[model samples]
Target chain A: MSATRRIRFTLNGQAAAAEIGTHETLVEVLRDRFALFGARESCSQGLCGCCTVLVDGHAVSGCLFLAAAADGVKIQTIEGLASGERLDPVQEAFLECGAFQCGFCTPGFILMTRQLLDENPAPSEDEIRHYLSGNLCRCGAYPEIIEAVKLASHKVKSRTPGGAAP
Target chain B: MTPFDLVEPPSLGEALKLLEPDDSAVRPLAGGTALMLLMKSGFFRPKRLVSLRAAGERLARIRIEPNGELRIGAMVRLAALEWAPEVRRDFPVIGHTLRTLANVRVRNVATLGGHLAHADPHSDLPPVLIALGACLVLAGPRGERAVPVEGFATGHYETVCKGDELIVEATIPPLGRRRAAYAKCTTRSADDWPALGIAVAWDDDGAIRSPRIVLGAATERPTRLKAAEALIAGRTLDGALLTRAGEAAAEEADVVADARGSVSYKKQLVKVYVARALRAAGAGPAAP
Candidate 1:
């Protein structure tokens, strides 16, 4: 394709199209084209997971991922985690546990916790710490975040049949 | 980041033809994690990037050959390596190395080929690959050639790979009776780039044989501690032998200082981590 090319993909479930530069990052495209602000870029480097997004059901750093690479993949973001009225179990757990103070990194932590629990229905404290180590919470609410992840695991397990949405 | 034309080649052959041996600005783009970082900071500017994402499944399969060697395609994501039953069952040391490599997000998107091709001295995988006696198959316009992982990287962020040559696959020999362990010291977070990395693999025939000790991160490149390996070879791995080997490794390594640590501190780290990794492998593979 040319320097700026059109790419078509499913964003948060709806089919979308955008003309993105080859150098444009997925985070820039989501925020600029889709007005999706949940995935904010804190550290341009992949070190801080604030710009975390799900590409084809796998978590990836939006900051490092090229927008051109998202052409045919299904993308999910923090904005898409909740349905019309119901919040995701992880989000509910985060709210109930007050897992964040500044809240700049809450969306990333919640999204990552969702992925972790999906892969591991029940993760030990050590596992939780290890999995979420990439996403930083400068507010220093790590203990409560761990508690929230555990609570979310229980809530997710106890949900009624078919309550889980893809 | 400057604008550039991104071309998606449908197959490995076409991708190679699209590459230019003399043009550094025209590069083959794999996972794009490391390259994106450099581009964002204005370290590198590119004219075109030949994306290999759609380049068929030939470079994405993890298959065990008839001879019991594991052939991992270059485009195989790091997460696939972590979750692959064959990798976890046979080469558990690789699994151990991936556990603390970056994080779930990076592993989900970053490819194994990019990790080695980047050749960052602080990377954790090259030393592990070298210790396992791995070989990388590089494909170019001329043909394909195999290079040992030890010599694949020449210096920090440098490799013997020509601009037109692309790594197609990495072949790791079956573990057999050899058990391996990798230990790294991260100065910041546990997942941060290592300050010192030590990987040891020895054929445990009830005693250490053909022991391979490789040191990384603390040195300019992944290097084999030949003196230490010779001393430990054909010897039983005991407490005293482990201590002496650690000292020998520290003395033999060409350690250089970086922001991560001072040269003296890394030498000490080499001493400690070498013994620690040897002890872990000395326990033997718990399963077999």
Candidate 2:
């Protein structure tokens, strides 16, 4: 069975193309074809959020996502979060809160937090915990991660026009 | 995962034509979450996959009919289904159950059809759907046929669907005056697969009538707790009645042991969660 496919998609706000085997997962393609290592695959299974990527503005496990399925979609990885030399607000909050110890799982946690804040700008502690439950940090930095999410929420709200009070 | 030919069929007719009726190696792919897991593990080596992602928007619409029946297209994502106002307003049990399913990312990609078609008995939706008397419309080369969700799965990872057939949509009847709830007992994390899952529903104007209790995850298939349903049929729910119903469910279910728990442990969970589900359903439908 020969199933090599060519897919074109918008990556990190730029149009890109890749010739991938039908069997190759999106994470594999992202790392191999585009040299984007921010979205690394730790747990090949979808249970771990280590491979989270945004497809059309929704989070999906890239390890389980077939590269051939990336055609005609807008994909965002952790690498796409920062512009030029400035870090996204979520990245700043994570660094300020010291949310990671090993940093292997940092990219995934940060990406998930970005989505969480996009959905709920002012999430309560319980809401934040519930949303981030899918992600796991082996360093056991959950307390700090929660703090980072709260900080990021505040940072995001402040950046919004006239909604800084939250 | 071995390399396999992938065909992106633009329509359901083209997708169905791509699938060989007797070839198990040729299969339809929807959402790709569940199948990707199988492919990664090498347990399933598909010769050809008919990708349904481009198979038209008719497979993605969620319509609430005038009769209040929910006609959910097979390809509707779980997260969309969870957040749909019509679902939360009419079928709150579905919304409540989905809130605790696998996780946000999986929910965003996994479709309702794949969830049922995969027939992973540990899933939360089947038992809940069985309790609500949901029906699946299976489209095949011949035509479409409707099957009740209760007997759709014959065993773990087994279903009545033929190799060539694809689930087109799921139709949930109007909840009307009945209240329903699903209770799952996860031995590990809160979002982990349940050691035991119990879904119960019935008419609740004054007395419980036509009570449907289905136990899942702890069993081979979604098993109806007929003895338990019969136990509480015409009675107003009270503590004593709830205990008796729970006991009946625990005795009637044919639970099997796995990583989730042992047979004895799951039997105990069955007793506890059955009562919890009935109590929750009796407390009245949840607020939107």
lDDT of 2 by residue, B85-129 (tens): 999888989989998999899999999999999999899999999
- In the range A22-66, model 1's lDDT, one tens digit per residue, is 899999999999999999999988888999999998889999999
Q: What's the DockQ of model 2?
A: 0.80
C-alpha lDDT of all candidate models, in order: 0.91, 0.91
What residue runs in model 2 are displaced by over 4 Å at the alpha carbon?
B286-288
Clashing pairs in 2: none
lDDT of 2 at B156: 85
Worst 10 residues of 1 chain B by lDDT: B279-288
